[model samples]
Target: MTTATRSTGDDERSAGNDDRPAGRAGARGVLSAYLALTKPRVIELLLITTIPAMFLAERGIPSLLLVLVTLVGGAMAAGSANTLNCVADSDIDAVMDRTKSRPLVSYRVPRTHALVFGVVLSVASFAVLWAGANLLAAALALSATLFYVFIYTLVLKRRTSQNIVWGGAAGCMPVLVGWAAVSGTVEWPAVVMFAVVFLWTPPHFWSLAMKYRADYERAGVPMLPVVATPRQVSARILVYTWATVASTLLLIPVTSWIYVGCAVVIGAAFLVMAQRLHQGVRRGRGVNPMRLFHLSNSYLSVLFLALAVDAAIGLPVLG
Candidate 1:
């Protein structure tokens, strides 16, 4: 071929190769973005509460299928809520370091697409839980979704420092959903489990807010740490930590000694970490507070797991 012809041919070939990888990467990015919208970590935490709640509500092994269905429904419902939250907060998210790369904010996914996906997922979750589990479970899941999407994200998130405190109720509903899934009704033990998670949410999220207060402030999100001084936030953390511990211990009346012991030890360690975070803030240090945050995560997971184990061993502490 002539020189120009060969150059043109090479350009075409290079363009073809470039297009192939770009297309593949684009597809992968879309898939990953969609999954990110699900808030998998949040769903995992929510699901952790489910198994324990089921155990606390059952004398014998609960229906494995019902547990599975409730988990799936809860995951989908929570994911949908998170996705819609992202869409609604896209503007603020774009300004915050922690949320800057979220699909809605980064334009990795369109707002309309995310909104539609969220609606579809929410509807499907309700259908699945209602048909596969029970109406009570489905209604609770639906209510949780609405609370997160509307009450938490829309009304409370920007309005007050106590946003997560009230919004946390949405997060705690999964325990009731799980319990009702098998028992078809709520019980005192399930209420205790709900209280445990309800009280746990504030300290868990407040520590994270402490670590990212600057981003929250810049985004005008009104998180507790952003609205309050570091010392004030730290004090709140300590207070909430105490409340969380107390609530977890209250589960002893409804759970086995194994769970109670786990809660006490974990709660004590959590309090220590919170105290350390408080001291750091008091001293004008800008520490990450990861110890408190990480410990809180572990505390919840292990506490619920203990309940599951107690159930598996054919023991019912309260029932």
Candidate 2:
């Protein structure tokens, strides 16, 4: 071949290799963006609550298929809700460091595309739960999605400091949905499970809100930390933590002594952490509050997982 032709071919080959990496990177980026829209951390906590609720509802092994369907449906519904939230909050999200990189906020994904994806997933999740699980579970899931997307995100989030307090109902519904998916009914035990999560939400969220009060202030969203003085937020966190610990103990009557024991230990630890956070905030120290926030996340996961393990071992939680 001519030297010129050889040089051109080599350059073309090099360019192809360069383009390949960029193409692969772009594909990976798209996947990461979509997964972020699902808000996997939120979904994980939601599923943790659902699993314990199922075990508390049925003392024995529940249908694995039903559990599987409920998980998938819940995940899809949650993802859709979160995606729509991002779409709705894109304006404010752009200004918040924690949320600035979200697909909708960053324009990595177009708002219209995200809207369509959210709608499709939301509808599909409801249909899947209805077909693969049961009508009650499906309806509950749908209600939760609507509550988060409309009530929490679009309405309460930007309007009031009580946002997490009332908005928490949406997060709490997964327990009812999971329970009904298995037994096709709601009962006191399910209600107890719901209450545990409902109460847990406020303190859990408030901790993070405290850490990001400035961002919330900048966004003009009335999160508790943004509206309340630090002392007030800390006081409320301790109050809610106390309530959560109490609710955890209430499960003792409905679940196994093993679960009750686990609850006591975890709840005590949670209280200690919360109390420290309160003290730190009172003293004008912010670091421990963030530590408490991280601990709270782990606390709920371990606490619920303990219940699931106890149930699986055939411990007499329901009896």
Q: Write the per-residue lDDT of candidate 1 for residues 1-319, one digit (tens) a residue.
A: 6646678768889789899999999999999999998888988989899887887688556888888898889898898888888888889989988888888877888889999999999999999999999999999999999999899999999999899999999999999999999989998878888888888898899888888989989988889888788889888889988988887776666667777777778878988888888898888887677678888999999988888887777655753
Q: How many steric overlaps are in each model, in order?
A: 0, 2
> Residue 165 lDDT in model 2?
94
TM for every model, in the order presented, reads: 0.92, 0.95
Candidate 2, residue 300: Cα displacement in angstroms equals 0.8
On TM-score, the candidate that comes out on top is 2
Residues 24-133 of candidate 2: C-alpha lDDT, one tens digit per residue = 99999988888888789998889888887787667766888878999999999888888888888999999999899898877788789889989999999999999998
RMSD of 2: 2.5
